[model samples]
Target: MIRGEWQNPALTRCDSKLAFRSLNQAAIQAERASSRTGELIIAYTCFDCGAFHIGHADLSQQLAHTVSVEPGCRECNLPIPEAKKRRARACSAKAIYCSDRCQKVAERKRRAQRQMASVTPQ
Candidate 1:
């Protein structure tokens, strides 16, 4: 979650569609109760828990704030394939995987290497 004054423990987690619907409903109620009705919200997946969270910021703006870096597959050391570049752009600044498959393969390899290292200690 982006750190700010808006962090709340009560924020419910939901999928993108449901979250937008709920945000709309809440915004409607808030608008009805208040004089302003320009309330805008966006849903983003929380990096901490892998859950969706809603925030009062534009998606493009939030994405713009992210500093994109050249990414490579940790397991293969291959520069992100051309096909995956677009997908990589949408990922978080710290994203490690060019794709889900790469992530899983890297994780499995890491675990195996760790086990081998542990069994062959100097």
Candidate 2:
């Protein structure tokens, strides 16, 4: 049996829904439900109850709402490509620099500025 808590105890048993404490648990339950019912189930956070819930997965609608905007490199302002963005996302990075050379150049400039500021006469 799936483990979850009722959203409200006072309300009618049918009126309240079961809420999962964590996204991971909800996702596991959703997967089981999908296989048992032959439907695409999804796990999502409930805005009103602040808990996870299982619902129907709508891939087409989700794909339509996704934005394609990619940010430029922080140091040289060069545009980042889709491939690089995907790689950065997989590695859990922000992808600030377009390349390692640009990152090194930016670090060197920052180091020089710090040294110059420290050496300035009072």
Ten residues in a row with the worst lDDT in model 2?
A: 6-15
Clashing pairs in 1: none
Which candidate has the top score in TM-score?
A: 2
Query: Mind giving the per-residue lDDT tens digits that candidate 1 earns over 9-91?
Result: 43433333233234455555444543343544445555554444455666876586568877577766666666566565677
lDDT per residue for candidate 2 within 51-79, as digits (tens), equals 78888778884576468866788888898
Please list the C-alpha lDDT of all candidates, in the order they appear: 0.59, 0.80
After superposing candidate 2, which stretches have Cα over 4 Å from the reference?
1-68
RMSD over all Cα atoms, model 1: 18.9
Clash pairs, model 2 backbone: none
Name the lDDT value of residue 12 in candidate 2. Answer: 48
RMSD of each: 18.9, 14.0
Q: What is the lDDT of candidate 2?
A: 0.80
TM-score of each: 0.29, 0.38
